[model samples]
Target chain A: MEFSSKVLEKAVNEISQLPGIGKRTALRLVLHLLKQPKEQTVFLSQALLTMREEIKFCLNCHNLSDVTICEICSNKNRDHKIICVVEDVRDVMAIENTGQYRGVYHVLGGKISPIDGVGPNQLNINSLVKKVKSGAVSEVIFALSSTMEGDTTNFYIYKQIQESSIITSTIARGIAVGDELEYADEVTLGRSILQRIPFENAFKNY
Target chain B: MEFSSKVLEKAVNEISQLPGIGKRTALRLVLHLLKQPKEQTVFLSQALLTMREEIKFCLNCHNLSDVTICEICSNKNRDHKIICVVEDVRDVMAIENTGQYRGVYHVLGGKISPIDGVGPNQLNINSLVKKVKSGAVSEVIFALSSTMEGDTTNFYIYKQIQESSIITSTIARGIAVGDELEYADEVTLGRSILQRIPFENAFKNY
Candidate 1:
């Protein structure tokens, strides 16, 4: 028996590919889309298409941007000397919304997960190291998550920057373990940034 | 300070307009779109656009379809003499998935909600009356939800169809209060369809 239409089947399959959407949820979304005004659906499609066609990785910070340099990197008022390293663009937006930090950001694209076959070479770590080695940078703040992999990347970057005579710091542990930086509220993120500690004795036990 | 790019701002606003999606969720969805491959985003966008441009209300049943007459309406094997009236297209799909009912369907667009200003005339009730008066229909089934408004609309349609000689019936009351027909599992829905009671004196008190 033909259970569903071809287009609907394809659409449902695609929706099911999303993080938490299951087959039933995918069906609900497709049915909802079918009922929506044609213009609304068109807008959704156009936004997604433009998101791919127009947006690109910022050459300087690796944040999503329409231009080579993201708005944060190009802004003159932002403190270029202080760079906050984060795992993704969502983390950068979370930090930006705090309004406490005037520093720019560098998105590592992803954390080093050996289980997932991700390594330092796969991330934008080389560009970050080059940026720090230029000697123009004053302080490098680690805004990566407090996960095990996050700590490993943080220590790796800390060791890389310490050899270049640049000051290195990591956001305070006030952020509870296993919590994502992207989901952290603005006030908590701001407090965490304000309570940053020097990384000279970082990983002293390890 | 500009929080996001102009296009991104517009896109985020558009995404936030969707039901259950807030500003932060909209931002997350946008970031997820950015992470997806260009082709994936483009395909989703095109699908949305195509859904709007290609799909239309089936003239016979008011269900969404790519053609004037829907697949069910055009099917030669479906029982034309037995018509099931429902609130929306999703209900039609649910009933169809059961593979038990071979009857055609008539979508009422919405239930009678005095609070929401939806009246009997606002729905496709007049056309339903016209279809019944044409004399080919033997039985008319009310598969609307058990909500207050659904009950009101079902009674209203019943009143309109009582003048005709055609038989009328309603799906069983085993479906719980405030439950949507679309979300009901196939087995329960199939049981309800099989145990449908005749419209005359089905409600004891009313």
Candidate 2:
């Protein structure tokens, strides 16, 4: 778009660089910002800068934290022996929201995607191995996506820790709890059937 | 959602305040930024701040600009006598993209919507009237949206300028270029048929 203000154009360009946001969306956002008080922009900019500068990854779990070690990893009430492996901080957040798991997380940062040039070395696999090799972690649960990359990363991590006696498992794959079985994809439906637990164990929450 | 980092929470809060962005989406955006090199955040922050600090509105048109007068209004190639009244700068950009118009623009800033607490006085109507009263403009075309608010604003402006001898017109409302007449809405189809232009005028661009 032909923006009369160079600054507006620059701001739109910067905003559009984000994933899923296009030039039209960026323009809408910038125009919305312009409509509001100038202080909103100041606050937004400050918040982003502050987050960028101060945010740190947990030294132990590799999850995003404000300090050297995250609260989940540092809390004694949580089970440190069970390490739930996730692809990113967002996954950690998602699992945390369930309020089901008591285990601390090991954030791999991303899956093993060869096409994207992301290898095992690029992720926090070594740190996780170090944690497991310390003999403190009893079980390592793989909670990555169901995609091929996710399975590859899970297998890669499982192989690295297979020598140890620590029990390794992956999160269950199935149709979502609220979804209709008829609409479920064939692969997931088949897997869900094969991995079906006893009726009592499945409805423990109820 | 529970956040390990305070800065991340704050950034998410600010981002989620924008229209259509929810907390989950905001978290996704924040995490994406975290995954990328820190320089991207710096660039985004710098662009927002620079734009907010340096941006100015054109004094004459009330459109966002770097200077007192916008480039469009100052361009000698555009017809200064014919002004296309629009709701905002995006509309101006949309019309400009067609590469058909040669007239300058008068940005109303926003449509008059009592429901949203926007009144005629709150907009740039006074400046538009001042421009019209100067007696240079020969035609004032209302190119606002077909919404009630847009129509009200156009009518209000039309009434304000009715005392003057200058001709006033509104852009046509009709079936879109590629629309099928069978599926067209009654209101628009009826209006298109009632205000049907000569066959030659309809295909002038062809």
Candidate 3:
């Protein structure tokens, strides 16, 4: 799409570079900014720049942090002995939102995706192994996605710390709690049946 | 949702202020930026700031431009005597994309919407009337949306220039080209029948 103004064209190009945003959507957003107060643009730009310039990674979990260690990893109430492994800070935030898990996190930065040229060496695997081998951890929970890359990363980390006597586990995968069984996909339904739990175990908190 | 870092939280808040973006989506975009090279964020911010600070509106047409008069209004090849009145620069761009019209444009900035506290005075209506009164224009095409507000604005402008000999007309409303008759809405289909054009004229641009 052609723009009447060079500045508008440049702004649209930059805004559309973001994921899930198209040129048309960027144009609409830029035009909206033009209609608002000039200070709004300054605030937005400054916020983005400040975040990118000063953001730091947690020393222990590899999650985003303002300091060396993130809040969850540094909190005394969180069970540091029980580390919940995740792909990135996004997963850590998602799990934290549930409020069910009280354990600290070990963010891997990413899963083992060879197609993307991401391997075990490219992740925070070594730091996690060192943490487990230190014998300060009792249990290691894998909260990675249920994809091939997640499984591979989980197994790779499990093998590295297996000799350290850490109780390794993964979050359970099945149909959603409130979903109807009739509408469940065949693979998930079959897996749920094969891995059925004890009747009493399903009502742990409820 | 809580963010681990203050900078991340601030960035997410600012980004989510844009239309159609939510806190979760903003967090996702911010995290994606974190994963990229820091220069990308700097570039994006700079482009937006420059556009907002240096952008100008064309004096004659009120369309976005880097100069006093926009490219369309200044172009000698375009028929300046035949002005197409539109809602905003977006409409001008949309019409230009069709490559069908050679006339210049007059951007109204917005239509008359009393409920939204927007009246004719809030638009670029007077400049349009003044341009017509100069006796340089022969025809004025009303290319605004087919909404009630659009029609009201068109009628108001037409009344203002009625004393002059300038021909005032609105875009044709009917079922769209290539649309199936069976699925056509009653209002549009009925209007198309009532405003039926000459059979040979329909084939002019086919």
* lDDT leader: 3
Taking the tens digit of each residue's C-alpha lDDT, what string does model 2 give over B109-193?
Answer: 8999999999999899988898899999999999999899999999999989999889898988999999999999999999999
Q: Best to worst by TM-score, what's the order? A: 2, 3, 1
Reference contacts recovered by each candidate, as fractions?
0.31, 0.82, 0.85
Model 2: CA > 4 A from native: A203-206, B203-206
Fnat of candidate 2: 0.82
TM-score quality measure for candidate 3:
0.93
lDDT of 1 by residue, B56-127 (tens): 777888877767888888999888899999998668878887667989999998899999888888788898
* Clash list (residue pairs), candidate 2: none
lDDT of 3 by residue, B22-59 (tens): 99899889988988999999999999999999999999
Weakest lDDT window of 10 consecutive positions for candidate 2 chain A: A197-206
CA shift at B26, candidate 3, in angstroms? 0.8
Model 2 chain B worst lDDT run, 10 consecutive residues: B197-206
Residue pairs with colliding backbones in model 3 are: none
In model 3, the Cα lDDT at residue B95 comes to 93
Q: Candidate 2: lDDT of A93?
A: 81
Per-candidate DockQ values are: 0.30, 0.79, 0.82
